[model samples]
Target: MSRNKQAKRPKLANEGFTGRLRFFVGRALLNIRQNAFVNIVTIGTITLAILIISLFMLVFVNLEGVANDWSKRVQVTAYFEQELAPEELATLKSRVLAIPGTDRVTYVSKEEAFKRFRERLKGQELLLEGITTDVLPSSVEISLKSASRNSDAVAVYVDRLKKVPGVTEVQHGEEWVRRYTTFMNFLRLAGLLLGSFLVLAVIFIVSNTIKLTIYSRKEELEILSLVGATRFFIKAPFLIEGILQGASGAGLALIILTGCYYAFLHNAGNFLSFNPAAAGLAFLPPVYSVGLFVSGVLLGFIGSATSLKRFVSV
Candidate 1:
């Protein structure tokens, strides 16, 4: 159908960029409809690949969020050698804030410390029957910056806090901190390896599928070449078609992903001990969602450009 439209328009005619692009897009749509089965198969395969990629990204993003939330709660507590005066506590807090990797400092008085302990032993108030405010040590809670959350960094920060005047000792969950950092590192590495693998796999699938489409239309391409059509002119419609297929597949994949995400949220409460929503489970953020669209466009362009290289000369 587009061949007939081109017959009257001639190959050498300058139709301008926008005009030619419009023609190419229209022709690409017509071609896809004509080869509906083949195009559907190609699009379906790509949709599945993109879906897997999107799903992996979703899980990784939420896991990273949960990790960040937990990591923020990791703090270094410094106990005072003796109870300090009001002015002394303020001065101590200011000095601890100046320490390397410190984000914030909160001074908990002996009274508050006992209060917290009492809250912890809510039902077992008997355990705190004789414990007085004087028995509890006043302490400063030093929160580390995000960059210094790792086990080694926390240990270094704790050591620095210990040297601060008036601080008798510092305690951070050293044992579990190392394990937590290790697990976070492993999660990051696995995400990188898996994401890269999925991206490469999808690109390969798209490239090969386009090549198949090219082979199916080989004769028409040969005819266009013999008729003196420029490489870009001859390749334009196919490139457009590839882009359209890629965009369609990506949209479909994202739609399915959103559906599955909502479905999981709706059902997560039925079987889980904890509330998924309360645990910080969430859909991909707006930025990441936009990235998927951009990724789709670039992937389409790459697949078509690569396929054209083998079939169309410079």
Candidate 2:
């Protein structure tokens, strides 16, 4: 080959990458600008769906947190019988402490319990006049390690506590805890069901929008095919279009979400001293946000390609 032609070859190849990228971006932009109304509609639909999903995800996450906090606060107070001797009471306390799943056990003497009652009824002198420490029952407060906090598991420990001397009542209910757990489970299930429906709707909306765009350009695609243009060359611009749509939709959604977070936080802060860390707002994780943008673009692109495939085969 001639030196001039050989030197031109490297430059041409280098230009190919830059040239193709620019061409793809230019074409995508042209199409978007030309079909501005359609693009806006497409973006709006996807944005609404994404917003609903993000809000639900935030609510469910915080609900789970609240439920967990309630569960952690759940404890048992074992009341002691008055006739029990000092040695028997000490032995009972030791045994209760040794029970499996028990984390920390606290003893509430009758005097302390009576003092609490007096303070509770501090303003009601008539009610407090006959009340005394001797009338108050001594009790032990039990906090279980997480694993042992379940109703069924705690029941076994409660049974063991009942068998100990001087133990009158072992208080922890299966029904109450079970109800709360069931409610939390329902929240999680509902979130999943709603989230799945929203995702499907987004995909369908995005895909249909792409299909319409493809149909509008059917004549151009056919001409490209007639000229012996390869499928990749024909499809590259559309794929880029999809990516741009995804990225833009995601970016827009994030901006809206950020505004919401700040507004809600601002309102909360005004009413009550709000700690930003504790609230854990409806903000998408960075990775998920990036994925959302990429996914949107891919969804648009793929839908376009799939719609075009039927026309291309001819």
Candidate 3:
């Protein structure tokens, strides 16, 4: 190359921060081009790993949405043995609202309760023929906060409600809530374990793959070391290369994930749910997508650093 053409190869050992950054980016790109096959393999491996983890996240995200939807049904009803005056009812509503984890307080008069019962037993109107408003209890229906819908929190909330004056009894679906909470906890634990394992596996794979590139350029690194190059100068380009590979892998994985998600929806819409039109299939949320991208970048950074520790000590 002519001197006026300015090759970056001769300027590796010394540069300012900005110059160093430019050099690192150029070198990373150069390395990727020169070792195109190895870099492609590394990026492909990263993409596969990211895709698997993202698929798991998509399922888990949908499950969490279902859980939140069901949790909305977790209501606690405080029944009164005798009917209360209008003022008494107002006072009770205020007190319940003041309690922690109370999302809403709905007062159900005896007549309203009777009407609801009748609606539920629509065809069995005969069952309610003799029943009057006095036959049913008037109650304050307490809808819980999202965070307090779990069994333990609901139990504590019920205990507090029972202590309120005029409350004869408090009832929530204890057994159902207990079972649901157990299942949710188990799901979270399993996701955590599996997610952790996948992340570590990808990092390991990337590290080993990067090691191959390092081995191929062993002599070049040695020459840079003898020429008084800083360790960071030698490591920066490889680190940047890893970052690029990681980011590209994540982007490609997301593209593939989107394609698969649409394909699933297209086919499943014909037969999947009882109401296929409202099957509610969803992709990863924006927050989860951000997490995936960050995970990819992290995978690359840690992997490249690990591989460079023993091999590139300029």
Candidate 4:
């Protein structure tokens, strides 16, 4: 009899892990079904919070794309000394092209510059009536590579252009670039602060919901404890429940966001056609989409963990 009892001990211990896993899963489902109202409220709250945050992220990403597009359009106009010989012009072009980060260099003859000026003075042709091509200096328009179009990079290029022998003046719109950079920085900071608040709010709401669930199952938990069940066995079901709620809510939010994104794209097609950047707007990238889902799971797990710490002590 002693040997038989000893043999059963190892078997029971081996089965304990699988038994606990099954118990946690079954109880989690039972609790979700039994407290349908609370589960719905919790899931709805999470969905709303995540949806708002996702929308903000989409806008920020697209705004960043547009800013990059604008930066790429930035060009430096270097006016050259008039009446340069053909050989001097060729040498200047070669030297400018050799500069790092120079994407393209176009020589704008005096005649072309005067033509562009006349086009700008459309209705006010009198401004150019007495002006000749000689009055405007020939210039080399330098386009910087995308990576070199920032304020500091453009400033460096301006200094280099000034040192070039035949160049008289360089205009790269430094003030405008500064203002644009400042505005982008402000937007990013504001978005980060707002996103942090939204995540905290989600955690708070989830924690309270889990606490209520725990309170309602207080008697069951006490019974499990009295029957020699471990603390992990008692708390595992509630943790699983919290994870389910978060994942479900996130899935719903993704569905709704996708529908709205496509609807807006379809309806606003005409309006977006007017802007080049708007035409290329996109939903969240795949990496960010995966991140949003992972964030939801973590939020739920953390909320449940916090609630369990308080209730398990009892």
Candidate 5:
């Protein structure tokens, strides 16, 4: 009998953990069902907040992609002097290649340049009818390495290229690059500020929703407190409820985001002329999707905890 009682003790201890979890989860669902209208309002608010954040993330990610593409495309064109010898041109190529950030240098012959120009104006050959290959300039197109494509790095290369012998002109669109960089920086800052505001708004909405839930169960909580229930026992269900609310809201938001993504993809051709989608815009990556879901759960838990701190006196 003693051995049997000891064995039963371990079994009961194991059951206690599972039993507590079930109790908390069940109570959370019960509360949600009992306060369906309020829960719906809270969840809807969270959905809106998360959806706005997701849209911003989508835009930010794609714009960042476009910026990177533009950065990679930055090139420095060095037009050579009209009567340069082969040896001097070869020496010039070697010198340009020796620069630290130089990725690769392509020498475009005058004839090749003329051919490219003709191809560009294929339908309107009349524009080039009077043009000769000698009228075009033989230039070296310098593509910078990925690590050296920024404004400062490109400026260093531009200064170096200007002093190179046999080069009559060096062109790098410094003004345009600077303006683009500034625009992207402003966009990033705006997204961050807007996201922060939306998160705070979500917290406030959740807190108020939980506060009402607490009020509805005020008498029950007071009774439990008087009956000597531990603080953890009293608060566990509310915390769980908050988590559910947040997770459900995030799930809804993700569904909406997915729908929007597919819709955008389906109708992408219509907006191709005006939008970045023309250049193969993609949805947020998997890691960011997971992050959004985690953020939602954390936000809900935080909001619930804040409300509980005010209402749960014990």
Candidate 6:
């Protein structure tokens, strides 16, 4: 008897695994086949949602990148007074560069500034022919150590810059910078709100899809319940079905995203000449792709779990 029981243990374990596998696979296929229309709709909705999410994430990241670059390169143009001497302007440039957060101060001589102005007015050579170095002011162009969109930090620098000698004007459009940051902040917030709405929408669509599939098998579920089957035993298959649906949908979305990115790179290669890999405009990374896929799968399972809870409760 002892030998027989030990032998039966291995058989039982194998049977259990095989049964579970069959149960899950059977339900997954049944769900897919039975609710073809609704399932397709759900997948479509999920794909659209993920695509929007991918695009917004790309835009937001690049916007933040460009903002940082602009901030770091935010030039504080310090124009000198008309009567300011060249020696005094040179001394002022040296002092300004010595300050903390000051990366470099380029002194734009009056002659160099006039030449640039003439170059810019290439077509209207007659208009700029009489222009001399005296017409352009000597100035120090300031570059900061780090790019930042922080208003307080920018305000502090603005105050300090105004105090420098030979500084006729320290001009930077703080309001303009503030507005741009605010706009980006608004976009970030709007994306969050939209993402939440889309996620909730996908959950509902998936739940209804799973619910319809479960309803078609109401007889089987009822019979199991009648035969003393536990809720876990009855719901396990449906849960697995939902997971399959979610995973498939995520995989499809990833494929679409990859294709779109590749197409963009291929077609827009000329515009992307400045950056070989187009560092500024890039697709979502592998980590994010995996995360999104997992999220979709989990959402499917959770939606199924929630929808099944009511039936089990009864």
The CA lDDT of each predicted structure is 0.84, 0.74, 0.86, 0.81, 0.82, 0.72
Evaluation by TM-score, superior candidate among 2 and 4 = 4
Query: Which regions of candidate 4 fall more than 4 Å away from where they truly are?
Result: 1-23, 82-107, 122-134, 144-153, 268-280
Estimate, for each residue in 1-314, the C-alpha lDDT of model 3 and write its tens digit: 65696365663554678876887899999999998998888889889989999998998888888888888888999999999999998899999998999999998999999999999999999988777879999998888999998899998898888889999998898998898889889989998998899777877776787787777777877888888888987888888988998899888899999898888777775665554226576789889888888888877777888888877755
TM-score of each: 0.90, 0.70, 0.90, 0.77, 0.76, 0.66
The weakest ten consecutive residues by lDDT in model 5 span 5-14
**Tens-place lDDT digits, model 5, residues 1-314:** 45554244344421578888998899889988987987887788778878888898898898888777877778889997684678988898899998889998998999889999999999999988767899988999999887777678888888888888878899878887677667767877887898788767766766677677667777877888899988898889888988998899889999999999988877876857555455677899999999998888887788778777777799
Give the per-residue lDDT of model 6 (tens digit) for 176-280: 667766766786788789778866775666667667656666787788899888887778877886777678877887888789777776777676556525555
Report the number of the highest-lDDT candidate: 3
Clashes of each: 0, 3, 0, 0, 0, 1
Per-residue accuracy of model 1 over 228-291 as CA lDDT, tens digit each: 9989888888878878887888888889999998888878899988878777788989888777
Winner of 1 and 5 under TM-score: 1
- Whole-structure CA lDDT of model 3: 0.86
| Model 6 whole-model lDDT (C-alpha atoms) | 0.72
Quality of model 4 by C-alpha lDDT = 0.81
Which is the winner by TM-score between candidate 2 and candidate 3?
3
What residue runs in model 6 are displaced by over 4 Å at the alpha carbon? 1-10, 15-45, 55-74, 80-107, 123-137, 143-147, 150-153, 163-168, 261-281
Q: How far is candidate 6 from the true structure (C-alpha RMSD, Å)?
A: 6.2
Instruction: Name the Cα RMSD for model 4.
Output: 4.4
**Cα distance off (Å), candidate 2, residue 75:** 2.3
Candidate 3 structure, TM-score to reference:
0.90
| Runs in model 5 lying further than 4 Å from the true structure | 1-16, 67-73, 81-104, 118-137, 145-150, 160-169, 267-279
lDDT string for model 2 (173-283, tens) is 667767765776687788789888878887787778768767877888899889988887788877777767766776687678778877877677667777655666446
